[model samples]
Target: MTHPPTTAIRHSPDLEGELRAASKVTLIGMVLDAVLGIIKVIGGVFFHSQALLVDGIHSFSDVASDLVVLGVMRVSRQKPDQNHPYGHQRIETIGTMVLGSILIAVGAALAWDNILRLIQGGADQVPGWPVLVAAAASVIGKEWIYRYTRRVGQAIRSDLIIANAWHSRTDAFSSVIVLVSTLGAMGGFIWIDTLAAVVIAGIIIHIGWKFTWDAVKELVDTGLSPEDTEMLKAIARDTEGVRNVHELRSRRMGHDILLDIHLVVRPEISVSEGHQIGMQVVSGMRDALDNIRDINFHIDAENDEEHPPTSEQLPSREGIRNLLDEHLGGLPSHTRIRLHYLRNKIHVELFFESPDDAPGLDAEQITRHLQGYPWFGSLRLWFGAR
Candidate 1:
C-alpha cells in the first residue's frame, strides 16, 4: 500500500468540455420546468379544467426536482479531498432521494386536492377547449425538453439527469391525458375530466415512488445488476496476466460505481509486477464501462508456494506506485517520505485492495518493522496490502 508516486496521466479535453456542456443543459431543464408548470396551472384554472390543473401540478413539481438535480451536479463537480476521499459524486444520489421525496409530496398533495374536489362535487363544471390547448402545448414542449435532456444524460452517462429526463416526459404524459379529458368534457360529461385528473394523480404517485425507492437503494450501496457484474468479469478475464477475476464486488453510489475485484496472477511474480498487471486490468475495465469512476483491483499470486522466487524481480520503490495503483481504485500513491533523524523513519501514505476473499498478510506488523530503519523518526503510514 505504501508506494511512491508514478508518472502523470492526462484527461481527455474533449470529454471534459462535453461534461461541462451537460451542466448547462441541466440548468436549462430546471428553468423550463418552472416556467411550464406556472403557465399550465394559470391556464387550467381560468378554463375550469381539472385535467389542465392535474397536468400543471405535475409539471410544477418538475421544477423543484430539476433544482435538486442541479444542486447535486454542483456538489459532484468538486474535487476529491480528505473529507470526501471518494469525491462528491455520490451527493448526486442524495439529491435524487430529495428529489424523489419532493415528487411524492407534490403528487400526494395534488391527489388530496382531487379527493376534496370530488367530495365537494367540483366535477360539475365543464372544462374549456382553450385550457385543453394549453395542456397540449405543455405536453409538446415538455416532450422536447425530455428529448434534449435525455440525449445529454445518455452521452454523459448521468443517471440523475436521465431519471429527471423521464420525469419531465411523465409530465408530458399527464398533459396528454388532460387534453383528452378536456375534449371529452365538451360533450357535457364533466365527470370525464374529473376521472382523468384522478388517473393522472395515480400516474404521478407511481413515478414518485419509483424514483424514491431507486434512490434509497443507491444510498444504501446496492450491488450492481447481474448484467454488469458479468461484464466486469469478462473484462478482467480478457486482460493480460490476469489468471481469473474473483470476488468481484460492485456497489452503486448515486450514478457512480465503486467496484473491487481480485486479479490472480502468476505466483512468485514480484508484488510490483503483480500490481502492474492489476492496473492494466483496471484500465481495461474503465474502457469497458466509462461510467465507472472508482475501481479497486487486488493483485494476488497464483499458487504462491509452487511458484519461483520473486524477490530479485521486484521493481525499485519509484516504480512501485504505478504497480500498486490498481489496488487504490486507480488513485496513485499520495506521498512517500524518508525522515533521517536519530533513526530512519519512513512515512508513507497508501491504499491496498481490502476485500474479504483476498485479504493479504498482516499490514500493521510490517509498518512497525519499516519504521525501525536507521533514519527512523516519526512514522506516518496508511497501510493496506492484498
Candidate 2:
C-alpha cells in the first residue's frame, strides 16, 4: 500500500512573510551597491587607483546580481500550479547559477585587464589620500550589508539569499585589498596596487565557482548529506509497525525535502494497518525535519529489495479460488478464502460455517491433491467463525 502525498506542513502565510523579508534585504543591498559603485569609480579616476576602479566595477556587478535575486525570489515563492506542481523554487537555483556566472565573467575580465597592465609596466603615479577614504567607507558599508543579508537568508532558509550575502561580503574583502594596495602604492611600490587587483579577481572567481557548482549539484538531483539521510532512516526504523526500512531515497526542491521509502511490515497485517504504520513514519519524519515537503512510503510484506517481486505468473486469488472449488468439490456456501503469496508460493486459509458443511474434507486430502502444483505453500482450514 502507498500513502498519498502530505501537504499540511506548509503554511502560506509564513512563506509569504519570508519572501517579503528577502525582497526587502535585496532592495537595500541594491541601493548600497549602486551608491558605492559610483563613488569608487569616481574616486579611482580622480585619485589614480586602478585597483579601486576595478573594485568599483565589482560593486556594480553586485547591483546587477541584486536585481536577479529580487526577480527570482518573487517568482520562486509562487505556489505550485498545474504547470509546476512542485512549485517554482528551482527558479531560484537557476537564478543563483546565473548570478555566479556573472561574477565569473566580471572577475576574469578584471583580472585579465590588470594582468595585461602589469605586463606592460605598472602605473607611474601613487593614489591620493581620498582613494583610501573611499575604500574604507566601502569596506564598512559592504560588511554591514553582508551581515544584514546573511541574517535574513538564514532565517528564511533561502540558498539564493545566502549566496547574494556572500557576494556582498566579497565586495567588502575587495575593498580591504584596495585599501592595503593604495597604501603600498603611496609608499612608492606602485606595482602593489596592480597586483592587488589580480588577487581580488581571484577571490571573485573562487566565490562565483563555489556558488555555481552548488547550484549545479542541486539541479542534478544530488541527495542530502550522509548525516541527514541516516537520520531519516533512524526515524523510520523507530516507527511502531515498521519491521525494517529499505530503499529510502531523498532529494531537495528548493529549501524543502522530498522522500520515498519501502517499509517492511508483518506479512499478515491488513492493508489499512500497513498504511497506518506508514502514516506514523511520515509524522515522525515531519516532526524531526521541518523542511520535509512530501513523503511517499510503500508498505511491503517482506524485504523485496533483496529478492525479485512476487512472480506475476503465480495464480491470482480468482485462479486459486477456482482450483479450490474444482478440487475440494463446491466449498460450503459463504466460505471465506484468504490467500498469502509469499516466497513464490501461496498459503491458503479457508473459513466455513461448520465441519459438517463439507464432509470428509481433510487437510491431508486437500494437500495431497494440490501438492502437484508448483505454487502451493501450505493450507489451514477453520471450521468456525474466523
Candidate 3:
C-alpha cells in the first residue's frame, strides 16, 4: 500500500490581525512622511541647503514605500483563489522588491546630482538657521515614528511593518547627517553639506539592496534556515511510533511555512495505525513551530532505501482470506487479519476478539498448510483479545 501526502491548513485569525496592524502602522507612517517631506523641501529651498533637500527626497521615498506596503497588504490579505492555491502572500514579497528597487534608483539619482554639484565647486554655499531647524525637527519626528512602528511590528512579527520602520529610522539617520553638515558649513567648512548628501545616498542604497536581496531569495523558494530545519526534524523523530524522519523539506510564503517530509514506522503496523502516527507527528510539529501553515507528510512502513515497493511480491487481502477459508475452515469469522508486505512476501497476523481462545492451527501448522504458496513469508497468532 502507498500513502499519499498530507497538506497542512493555516488558521486565519493571526493573519487577519497582522494585516490590520500593518495597515494601521503604514498609514500612520505615510502621513508622517508626507508632512516631513513637505517641511524639509520648503526649508531646504529657502535656506539653500543641498543636504536638507536630498533628505526631503529620502522622506518622500518613505511615503512612496508606505503606499506600496498598503497596496500589497490589501492584496495579500485575500484568501486563496483558484489561480493561486497558495494564497497571495508572494505579492507582498514582490511589493517589497518594487519598493527596494525604487529606493535604489532614487538614491542613485540624488547621489549623482550632488556629486555633480561638488565637482563643479558650486555646493560651497552655506545654509541658514532655518535649514538646521527643519533638519532637527525631522530627526525628532522620524525617530519617534521608527520606535513606535518597530514596537508594533515585533509584537506581531510582521515583515512589512518592520521593514517600513527601518525605512523611517534610516530617514532619521539621514536627517542627523544633514544637521551635522549644516552646522559644519555654517562654521566655514563649506564642502561638508555636499558630502552629507553622498553619505545619505549610500545609506539609502544599502538598505534598498538588503530588502531586494531578501525578497528575491524568498521568491526563489529558498528553504528555512538550517537551524530551523534541524528543530523540525527533531520534533518529527520524537513523535511516538515514528521510527525515524527523512526527506524533510520546507518553503516560505510570506510569514508562513510549507513542509514536506516522510515518517517511518514499524513495518508490521496496520495502515490505519500508520496514518494515526503520521497525524501525531504533524500535531507535535505544529505545536513546536507556530509559522507552519501546511505539511505534506508521507508515511513509510520501512526505510524506502532498503526495501523498494516494486520488489515486493505478496498475496492480496482477498487471496489471503481465501487461503484461510480453504485451509483453516474452523477459524471464527470475527477474527481480524493483518498482512505486512515485507521482504518480498506477506507476513500474516491474526487478531481475535476478547475471551476468544487460540485456534486449533498454530503458526507453524498454518505456515505448513500454505507452504506451497511462494508469497507467504511468516505467520503469527495474537490471542489476547481486546
Runs with alpha carbons beyond 4 Å of true place in candidate 1: 1-19, 110-122, 238-240, 302-386
Best by lDDT: 2
Query: Any runs in candidate 2 off by more than 4 Å, and if so which?
Result: 1-14, 325-334, 353-362, 365-372, 383-386
Q: Model 2, poorest ten-residue lDDT window? A: 1-10
- What is candidate 3's lDDT per residue for 218-320, written digit by digit as tens? 8999999999899888988988988888679899887678888888877766667877887887788888887788787888767766666635345678878
Identify the superior model by TM-score, candidate 1 or candidate 3: 3
- Model 1, range 213-236, lDDT digits (tens) per residue? 988887777898899899889988
**Weakest ten-residue segment in model 3 by summed lDDT:** 1-10
TM-scores of the models, in the order given: 0.67, 0.86, 0.83
Candidate 1 structure lDDT: 0.65
Runs off by more than 4 Å, candidate 3: 1-13, 81-85, 122-124, 269-289, 309-316, 322-332, 352-376, 383-386
Q: For residues 212-303, could you state the per-residue lDDT of candidate 2 as single tens digits?
A: 98899888888889998899899889999888987788877777787878888887777778878888888888888888887878877767
* Alpha-carbon lDDT of model 2: 0.84
Candidate that scores best on TM-score: 2
Candidate 2 vs candidate 3, TM-score winner: 2
